[model samples]
Target: MRAIFPIVTVVIVAIIGVIVFHLLSFPMPWMLGSLFGVLLTQLIWKIPMKWPVMMRNIGLLIVGTAIGQLFTFNILIAMKDTLLFMFMLNIVLSLFCLAMAYLLKKWARIPFATAIIASIPGGLSQLVVFAEEQKDIDVTVVTFFHVIRVLFVVGLIPIIVSLTGEVPGAPAQGSSNLLHNLSLILLGLLLLPIGKKLRLPVPHFLTPVLIGLLLSLFKVDVDPMDGHLLHIAQLCIGAYIGLLLHPKSLRLPVRVLIGGISSAILLLVLTFFIAEGMVFFFDLDFATSYLSTAPGGMDQMGLIATALQADATHVTIFQLFRMLFIYVIILPILKWKILK
Candidate 1:
């Protein structure tokens, strides 16, 4: 009974979002609709909306499996061809983050640690957790900036893709056998625990994707999920993201809010330049390049790539590379230099 109102609110907002986006012919209507719908509702009413974590994990599972269907040999070959470029991009993005952090420290009057953590392009949750362990770092401000960055990227990238006329690909037609689809789904589910046990980032998404990729490599005939299932997955993910934007938690001065918004805009602009570079140098498509450079969560970017019929595998790989570079390399250096 206690959870009923929030659940109802989410459903109502999501329905409204779907209708609005559909009417407007928006790209990734279900996702963008639910995201903005709940976002607007939360902003206006200041409602306490909560979507269960398990529901989001379930959505990730579905989306991961769907993306995995694209892990064919040809895609793998293409990814290999671009491996060096991806590595360079990751390094360049890391430097861009550090430069932004310095600007924040200078202009925003943010403490060094907070600015550094907030400036980081990926690892929002991890950065927040790390900030909690540091002295004189405002976790609220860090979270505010991180949340705003993700919201800005997610909200805008799809619209840009739509404007560029990146049409959604034909819906996947997997094996017609129900049992086969069930088995693939179950396999993905079973891998979740292993991913968690291994302490992988975004285990719910990464585990299933890796499992699906392995199955694909072995020539296992996994069924692609229907379009309706994909929409449901998008709805779940969008609602979860919407619920994350707690305006009440952002107890900052107006100046600070302005600074945070500026930082987010700067990051978005840098992402756009990098993406364009990829297009010119690597000759990747607009959707793929934009998604690869977009500074949103890996799972969210992958979802957008899947929706836009971009190379999901390429997006996933690039995102994973950035995450790994940030967490494994940049984070340690930041800790040593700033925290110590």
Candidate 2:
């Protein structure tokens, strides 16, 4: 009976999503669905059943794969601008962290690497993986801080949208061109085992970047077109996040918590102004610049673009570029110089 409850919950949420689709004229209200799921899980059963976790993971894998497939060759042309933005964004984000880290180390008395890990944008899984790799840092501390950052970003974004007088595509639902989406998903899954065999450096979804670049070599494009699939994917990821809530686990000292929140929000606002200036200087669009500096994951930023119906291409370009910077430059530098 307990096992069945989560299954029942998912069915109910899906039904609600469908109903929302029709009533809202196709907007899925992801934030509402997510909050409802989280609140329901907490209230109905503060201790989540295995079924809920399983369902949530399925949603994560599916949505994450689909979102990853959106990468393509045009990213190359935009690479120059993105790289420049990375250099600039990196300096700002790092400095913001550096100052915050000093404060955290002084008051919180945590190590520099732990503080830096906490300051990282999204990429929680990678942070965990790296935490494991680092000999000295407390994985628990890094995880705690990263979790705080995610909560802050997710919470703040909706508020920002509300202030802008746009509800986002909250109840978004529409035809997602998913003809080849399954194939891409399958391919992403396939890469995991193969990568395990081949010892690839990153997660399976990352291979699509290499795959995209290689496909570009042959002038072959495979950016999947199913927007509906993307929505479902986002739903899954969002659900997984919702399941992660536990007010009990957030027992941080008030000073550190306040400092972390202040640093992130301050950096977010400052980066927004800087990004806007950079966009104007580079003749880029407003929506694109706004998203690129929006503080958090690439997929989340892209979702913002979709919800607002903004310039997705530019957002994707810079977000991906910035992420690549994190992967290749920032991660390695921090790992080598600081974490190591």
Candidate 3:
């Protein structure tokens, strides 16, 4: 009962943000609005707010389930041709991120391990876990960098994609059947433990995605959720992100903050050039290629892809491949080469 009030307060504030952004015709109004709303309220008023990890997990599950349904038989077949490209792209992108890590190391005067871990464009949770295991690495700096970068990427990418032009196909119209979605939600819940047991990098999100993809391959009829559900998911995620950026929570030197922000911007610029290269080399549009390669959170990019009606199937594959690459190949090499 005591904790519930704060939760309800933030939710109400987040809803107001959604309403305001929706009125302004903003792209990703629910997410952007709720995110900024909660962030500003906390920063300005210092309101007591609390969003549970479970809320965020629920949001990821919804997003993962939606993205999973995108993997149709034809789409999977088409993705085969790009699998090699995706692998190569991850290597190149990781290399560039490492280079930027060196720059961040010098600019911020932080240890190389801390800089590299912070600069690596991997999942925040996973990166933080990695940082926690290492000696002399500032987990706070790593968390701050990723959070700021994700905030920038999430806030900017959707607007840029919206400004570029309309997405080619029709927007996804989610199923209206309550029972079907409820069953899917139940299944996602059941898989949670399995995901944790497997120790997948991002178990909540990836587990549902894998399940959805398997269902797709087997020709199961799970309707992709519509805007209403997506809105709720966005609200859940956005509000939490807003709280993460609560100004008081971050206590770092001005130089480090500047380095973190500038490095994040630099990464976005670098990603844009790579995205352009993707456009030139492959028969892909800028939006799909950009979102696919952008070193942001997979869930956030997935959300933007769905909103833009870009090749979400392609985006999911590329993002997933990058994530796995980071965990399996890149992190191991870093641990052995750098930490050793």
Give the best candidate by lDDT.
3
Extract clashing residue pairs from model 3.
174-226
lDDT of 3 by residue, 56-146 (tens): 8888888887787776677778788888888888878788878888877787888888988998899877898889999889888988999
Query: TM-scores of all models?
Result: 0.94, 0.75, 0.94
* lDDT by residue (tens digit), candidate 2, 1-340: 9768865665556446445644664333664355445545654565543225445444444544544444456665656655766677766776777777787888787787787777766466667787888788877677767665666665565456446543424234344445565676666666666655765334443454445455557776455436666556556555555545456545767766676667667767876687668667876555556676766666566565655555554565566666666777877888778766
Candidate 2 ranges with C-alpha deviation above 4 Å = 1-28, 35-72, 158-162, 165-178, 192-204, 208-224, 311-313, 331-340
Model 1 residue 88 CA deviation (Å) reads 1.9
- Predicted structure 3: clash tally: 1
Candidate ordering by TM-score (highest first): 3, 1, 2
Model 3 is weakest, by summed lDDT over 10 consecutive residues, at 166-175
CA-only RMSD, every prediction: 1.9, 4.6, 1.8
Candidate 1 wrongly placed segments (more than 4 Å): 168-179
Please write out the lDDT profile of model 1 over residues 242-322, one tens digit for every residue. Answer: 877786756687766887788888877887888888889887888889998888889999998988888788889889888
The reply for model 3, stretches above 4 Å from the true place, is 169-175
The TM-score obtained by model 3 is 0.94
